[model samples]
Target: MLLMLLGTLGVVMSAAGWLSYRAGLQEAGEMFDARLVQSTRVLVSLVDEPLSELNAYPGEPIVLRGWHGEAQGVGEALAFDDGHAYENKLAFQVWDTKQRLLLRSDSAPTTPLAVAEPGFSDVVIEGARWRTFTLRSSNGRWFQSAELADIRQELATDIAGGTLLPLLLALPLMALVIWWSVALATRSLRGLSMEIGQRHPERLVPLDPADVPREAQGLVSAINGLLQRLDVALARERNFVADAAHELRTPISALKVHADNARHAIDEQDRVQSQELLGISIERVERLASQLLSLSRAESLGGARAHSRLDLDALVRTEMEELRPLAERKNQEIQLTLEGAQLWGDEFALGLLVRNLIENALRYTPAGGVIEVRTSSTGTHAVLTVEDSGPGIPEDERERVFDRFYRRLGGGSDGSGLGLAIAAEAVTAHGGRIHLGGAARLGGLVARVELPLDT
Candidate 1:
């Protein structure tokens, strides 16, 4: 930041210096030109008496000598107000109508200072530059005043340097001021960084916005929101792990008991019975473990799923085909009114969602009950429904059924109670909605799901 500020200042100052130099040079030129004109008028008036009687004067024109003294400092040029040190640098000449040199100063060249043209002009004499101004008089003679060019240039350069020196000297100080201001402005940001770095992993508390500057309030707010979400996800994960441990302990203990019974049985029939019970316990534990894994996978399905365009009705038909034999063995009829609904979602998540709803229906409905499944669209959403003509859930328990490990008291099914929870998570991952309500004309629980359309 300091470098950038300093660089910008340097460029502006350089441009200002150049412009000042040009202005100084132009102003000095005008002032000197005016002095040349005044000097010409004075010399022309003074030369009247000398040219009136040309024959009275000698063969050469008389010269007005100037002081030739040692150079000094400060007021050296105009000391004592008698004459200037630069008097030798200022020269004048007068000429008659025949171009004869009538009068000249000691420093004036014997040759004509410039062409007979009236007004200002430049000339080179003895490899040195001079500025000359000529004027026509009523007597038909001409007067020319001249001065050295280098003197005027030196004064102009001095004026420009004097104007620009202070600004250049202040550049470092300006850089210091800019750096201090930037540091003061960012102090709060540094503090915020330190606070975040010092946080404990379990410390998901939000940062206070009161101390933050208005310019950075939005950033602080976003960070706080992230911390809040992380806290929620962590709490949920803890609860899931605790519940899974608790649920697995009972089945594992039963498996161990049956294994011991089978190992110590005396008779062959007793050993076989014990082995059968052991197999049942093992199956129960396996199913419980599988349900816990599904629940874990469902909870993590928000961001890591591969999504695709899927036919909702087609996925429903596939699950029905897989479960049709189970429904047939129970003497139950599986009814489907598939209307070919198209949706965009994760294929695995949506397939699981479909299968869970249908299987729950098959498990809960009595023998020979009707399982009604339907798929349709509402322009922006594709809808799915699986309903069974069985004892529907109580109105009070309908919402709780979607919670992990929740089951109705007398539902007559030995489910691990994660199927509905898994279905709920899959619907949420797809930005969909699901609800359990009474079926139309069937008087049983209806699980209706709605998802965004593919378009």
Candidate 2:
């Protein structure tokens, strides 16, 4: 992160410096042009009369010697009161209307500096380029000032260098500050990672959010929420495993006893009786396993209900058809009033819900009893009711029947007590409700499930 910040800052600073350098050079060039014009006007006013008296020395032009050469140090001339080092790079000339050189500086060439015109111009002499400005006075004497083009360029470069030097020196210090700031900001996150890394497998405690940065608070909150959900899922799994172990033990023991009895029986009649008992034990175990699976499937659909359109009446009919044999074996009559009610739900989950309710009714009702299956819909809700002519649950114990592994004592039904719980699970997952009450028509338990048609 620090490297990224420094890299981005470096790129921005480089572009800014380039623009500043170009602007400085351009501004310096304009100032140099103005300086040439202003110096020409001032010198022509001051020196016109003095140099006129020296017209006798026409070719000699009152030469003023500056620095000799590059042999002297730059500050040596200024310190010793000679002349500035740059004086030799500057020169001036005067020309009369006939283009004759009336007077000139020593550094200037003996030939005419430029064409006899006004304003600024560039000229080359002895392979060295010079920038010259020409001014025509009122008296018609042409005053011209010239400077080395290389000197103007060198000064512009120096000015630009001076302007950007401070920033270059401060860049390293800025990078250090940025690195420190980023490290400080991420210190809490690093600590959180270490805390999670060293935790025990079963330790799903949430991290403290007090020290978290505002920017990372959401991340921490999401992680905590995930941990909370994982904790619940793990606890549920553990309970399921424990309950399965306990529930399977009795039937398996009975199967072993019955098998042993059948194997040890001396007579054919005794063996046949033991085998029948063994078969009953096997069926009970199968029923328990199937109910456990249904409960699991229903619970797992909590947040993952499918969004398929299905007819509630049709779905209930399908479930009822599968369980018709159980109702027939008991000589129970099934009276179904299925309307064409449409619903949006998980087809498999709704099947589980309907099957459990109808099967419970079929199992608990007396032989030759009446079971009524009905489906209907209000404007916003679809409802399914399975009522049977069996002893209904007492109002005080009505809610407990939905608990996992719960049963009303003395109910003589071979139920695993998971049927109504599975029904409840599916109904709750669909954002719906189920009620257990005495059926007024059938005079028994009524398992009525209500679901939203658009859920």
Candidate 3:
């Protein structure tokens, strides 16, 4: 940014300098032309009578007296100590109507100073260019005054140089000022970087936006948002660890107690009962670990790659196939009604969501109960619903069931209390919503999921 600003400034300054030089040259040219016209008028007034008395034939030339600028007689009093070196460059001539050069200055050319046309003109005499101005007097005499072109050009160059010198000399100072301003403007960014760098890893506090320039406000806002998310994710991870430790501690203790019981059993029947208790304890630990892993995976889905487009109906049908064996073991009938629903989402996560819902229903439903899974699509949304013959959740408890490690009281089911929580996270990751209510047709619990068709 600094380089670009400097480069632009340099180009603008250079163009301005060029324009100033041209304007100076033009003004100098106008002034020199005016001098030429004034000199012609003055010489015509002085030489008109002298040329009339001269006995010259037509087209004849005669020389008149001219000044050398040396101190002589009365000219000594008029001469200045510092006279211009260009005084000798001026010349004049007088001519008759017949194109006869009757009178001319010593410095002037022997030939006519210029063409007979009246007005300013450029003429070359003896290899030297001259700026000449001519006028016709009332007595029919042609008066001409001229100056060397080199003198006028030198004056124009001096004027233009006078105008451009200071600007050229100050360019370095201007560059220094621009560099200082750019550094001062970027100081705030450096400070912000320093502030962030000095922070500890655990310090996920937001930076003060007011302390930054307005140009940096959006960047600061984005960083603050990231810090907030990091704080939330860190808090959740801590809670998950604490909850896992707490949940595992009870089952681990039970397993230890069962091991001791089996070792101290007085009879074979007592030892067999202890072994069964130990098995139950081990199953509880396994279930807890699986639920924890599922919950962790669901939470991470948001940061993973985008989900792919899939047929929701087909995925659910495949999940039902996998869960059918468990349903048959419980003597529960499973039914699927699909209508070619489609949506964008992680297939594995969606399958897990369906499995959890069905597994929950299977654990709680009585023998000979019926479970129904349905998939269909509207114009804007893809819908999935699982209805089971198990007891329905109360309206007041339905919302709370999605909370982590939450379970209904007196549910009489051996669950890790994380299935609904995992399902809720997975649905949220897919930008979908889930609802719980009594199944109108099944007369039991229903889990309904609605996801955008184009998500």
Candidate 4:
């Protein structure tokens, strides 16, 4: 940015300096022309009276008044106590109508300064160009004033240089100022970078946006949003680890106890009983591990898995079919009503969502209990509901049931208490909502999930 700004400044300054120089040159040329015309008029005013009384002698040489030498003489001396170097650059001459030179200055060329035309003109004498102004008096006498073109050009160039020199000398200072201004403008960005870089790796808190420039406000907001999400994900991961450790302790201890009982049992029947108990403990551990994995997946779904469009009805049917044997083993009746529900969501996450709801229903419902699963869409939302013929959650505890590892007082003793929590996370990741209440028909717990079809 600094380099670009400096480059632009340099270009503009150069263009301005060139234009200023051109203007100066033009102004100087006009002043020089005006001086020439004024000098010619002054000569006509001063010489007309003097020349009219003088009679021109034919074939007689014209003698200049100021110098002792004749008008045609070369190498003649003219002395002044304090003469300027520019004196030789100006010259004047007077001529009669018959074209005889009446008077001349030392610097004037022997020939006429210009043609008999009565205005300003350019002429060359002795290989040097001159600007000349010719004027005719009322007596038909002519007066002319001329200056060397080289001297005029030199003066014009000096004027243009005077106009451009200051800018040329200040180029370095202007570039420095531009560089400093660019640095000052971008100091906020640098501060933001430094603030981020100096933070601890575990610190995922947002940066302050108040002092940020308007152009970078959106960028800072986006970064703060990402930081908030990272903080959430990190907190979830830490909680999952802690919860998994806590949940693993009971089943693992149970398995250890059963293993110890089987090892110390004297009777074969006692050993068989211990082995059975150990198998049950192993199953609980496996179920807890699976539930923990599902919780992690749901929490991690976030924004990354929200792209795929899935059929809620199809996913619900598939999960129900897979869990059918589990229901049949308990002599439970599983009723499914799929109503062509479609929504935008991750297929895998939505499948998990459906499985968790139905599995929770199957776990809590007693033997011979009826579990009703439904999938339907209402234009803007795809809804999935699982109702069970089990003890319903209390209204006060319904919201807390979605908390990680939270369970009701009389909930299933062997459960990991993560099914509803995982289901809730999945719904949230898809920008949906969940509600828990008593089923109108089943007279038990009802877990209703409303997922947006538009996403």
* Winner by lDDT: 1
Q: Each candidate: what lDDT?
A: 0.87, 0.86, 0.84, 0.83
- TM-score for candidate 3, please give it: 0.72
**Residue pairs with backbone atoms closer than 3 Å in model 3 (clashes):** none
Cα lDDT tens digits for candidate 2, 1-455: 88888888778777777777778778877988999999998989897777565636455455657765444543354343555667778898988767777777888988877777898999999998989999887768888999988876776666666666777788899988988899899999999889989989799989899988999999999999999988988898888888878888988999999999999999999999999999999999999999898888888786666789999888988888899999889999999998878889998889999898899999999999999999999989998989999988999999999988887899978688889999999999999999999899889999888899889
What digit string (tens of lDDT, one per residue) describes model 4 on residues 1-455? 76776678778777776776677667777998899888888888887897677675546435443323223211233333445446677888888888988777878877899998899898889998988998998999888889898765666566666667787788788878888887887899999999999999799888998888999999999999999988887887887898899989988999999999999999999999999999999999998899888888877877554667777777877888899998998999988888888877888788888898888888889889999988888889888888999988989999898887787777765677888888888888888899998888889998888888878
Instruction: Judge candidate 2 against the unseen true structure and give its global Cα lDDT, from 0 to 1.
Output: 0.86
lDDT of 2 at 9: 79
Residue 146 of model 1: what lDDT? Answer: 95
Q: What is the lDDT of residue 187 in candidate 4?
A: 91
Q: What TM-score do all the candidates reach, one by one?
A: 0.78, 0.88, 0.72, 0.72
Q: Tell me the alpha-carbon RMSD of every candidate.
A: 4.5, 3.1, 6.2, 6.5
Backbone clash tally (model 3): 0
Give the local distance difference test score of model 1.
Answer: 0.87
Candidate 4 wrong stretches, greater than 4 Å: 1-13, 44-83, 92-105, 108-129, 133-144, 150-196, 203-229, 249-290, 301-310, 328-331, 377-380, 394-397, 407-413
**How large an RMSD does model 2 have?**
3.1
